[model samples]
Target: MDLGFSQATAVIVGGGRGMGFATARCLAEDGARVALMGRSPDVLEQAAAALVEFGSPDAVGVVVDTADVGQVEAAFAEVGERWNDGLNVLINTVGPDAVGGFEDLTDEQWLAAVDGGVMGMVRCVRAALPLLRRAEWARIVNFSAHSTQRQSEILPAYTAAKAMVNSVSKNLSLSLAKDEILVNVVSPGSIASEALVGWADSVGVDGSDPYRLMEAIDEHFGHPAHLPRAGLPEEIAPVAAFLASRRNSYMTGANVNVDGGSVFT
Candidate 1:
């Protein structure tokens, strides 16, 4: 579990809060130099400071909206100037969750979902490729979702975008293999992040008890994992850290599921 992360350069999109912050914390704790990218300057600043407290020597924050290609490219250009050579890891956690049912989704909503879920990751990866290729050890970890595997009627745009992510990740693994850049995907089940917790509370479901929370989720969203609980951001973070580290050699073109046994495929 050392992850061999000492002095590695990591850039995390959406690293301001939630699972993104959780994963960046894990990397920082293992001695990675993390650059957190997000829209909110305050959140990014707080996260970078916390990463330093967690053990990162050079944790920095950059403001960027993944929806905008210009912003994403500019952010990476700044990171390139800072690092001066290469990026060891690129982790993207910016994506849209299910908003409404198919009947409820407007053209604009669907477009937004694809922009956030698929193109967001694509933009980051495209910008980071040069740095990654120059790296001594490079890893790309893209976030997908368990819903992509099990299927959710209410999550059409989100699921479709994640499926595209999965497909694109596999292709990148193959294409980037020659450069020795490891490209993989992490598909998590429903995790107890801030948004999920707020949604649960809004729906009158208490997540205090794991089993009961899962039961309520089953009744509400029909998303009950075999483990019978929502996953924690901490639980998903370490797996991502491993994937984004020097220790993960020979694993590529794979979608690793951390969905509490919800996805058999």
Candidate 2:
């Protein structure tokens, strides 16, 4: 059961909520020192406290704006100083979903998606490079969405940006192979999270019952997955944990889909 992550240090960008928080809990439960980096001070504090409660007493909350280059650099530097040992894993889950059709999207909207989705990962990876190099083994797990595989009319720009992220991850995998640093991507499909619940509420669906909300989403958005319903954050966390662990020594540049059979390999 021990994935050998007890002493490894993981920096999770956007670790305050949803899948990021779930992944944080996974690593922490396996005894990793986790630093949650996000923009919200309160959420970061609460998340870090929750991690500590989950058995990672050394968990830290790092407030960072991924879109800001300076903040990203400073945050990583602080993580290095705080951990002092090394950074074993870097998980970039900070990205925005741009809704609306291609024609409805303005130049500003397109740029926003690129800036938040693509450039955010770029900045985080650049900042974490030095710390990651210090570790004996390093893993970079980036987030993409299943929407890239099954295009959505409402998410053209977002999907394009995620495709770019997947491409960049593959390139990084090749470039970092010599260093023995593994780089990969995780594309999740319709994972039940707070955002989804809010979405359901906005559309007059019952948010209290997650399954009902998921069903509503599937009805509205069409779930092509073999599974009957949406996935939970916990369901996606274990895959990310394994990918971020030393056990995943051979898998690199692979975009693993946690989409409940919605995406075919």
Candidate 3:
């Protein structure tokens, strides 16, 4: 299916690895000119090099910590100056998981969660709005968690921050509708990725041997979803690509759950 993304310019914040890299690959494969932004130059270079091999030879990597507003603005400006193309899509795949019960979370932890998850999206969208408005079609897909709907435990700060993301996306959708720039949210459940693995480690779970731990987690929580297994980064990427494309013209302000029906009940 042609997504009408050829020649489109996409800025994927946190596009170094995991779901971010997967989404970047999907978009570029469909012919979008992609700029990968993240904190690590090496990882971003690797991701951009892979994209170059796939199709987008002009794909560039910029080191930008999403948690910092100034860095995000600079990265967007660099993309604008280099590409001389309007921003067609902005995907925020920044993962800021603070593992701990409410009592265990320090003020610093909570603030960081809000900054990385909520304010990060806010900053990127604000910076990209002008460029996005220039495009005939523009999209902003914000990464959220299914836990916000399921109300999972032990993620007070994380859930709160994602809730803010959901709200912000919806509000942006309404405000940007007149300009034809779509804003939407995607919530995925238990996608197997480096981010999830690091989250497990932060929570004191041994995922160094991920095969075993993934099996155990699947046995415990996989039953809720109809698929009876965790999702892969690749599986989540196409959904995001569709949302960021012209094909998803009517889906603004919606929170699409790609959770294998985990939250249906």
lDDT for each candidate structure: 0.89, 0.89, 0.84
Error of 2 at 124 (Å): 0.5
lDDT over C-alpha atoms for residue 159 of model 1: 92
TM-score for candidate 2, please give it: 0.97
Could you tell me the C-alpha RMSD of candidate 3 in Å? 2.6
Write down the TM-score of every candidate: 0.97, 0.97, 0.92
Q: For candidate 1, lDDT tens digit of each residue in 1-265? A: 6899999999999999989999999999999999999999999999999999999998999999998899999999999999976999999998876578999999998888888899999999999998888778899999999888887778888899899999999999999988999998999897887887776777787765556667777887788888868888989999999899899998998899998887776
**Local accuracy of candidate 2 as per-residue lDDT tens digits, 1-265:** 7887988899999899999999999999999999999999999999999999997879989998888899999999999899776799999987776888889999999999999999999999999998899999999999999988898777888888999999999999999999899999999998778888788889998765756766886777665567766788889899999999999999998999998788776
Which 10 successive residues of model 1 have the least lDDT summed? 207-216
Model 3 misplaced stretches (Cα beyond 4 Å): 198-215, 218-224
Determine the backbone clash count of candidate 3. Answer: 0
Q: Give stretches of model 1 more than 4 Å off.
A: none
lDDT of model 3 at position 168:
93
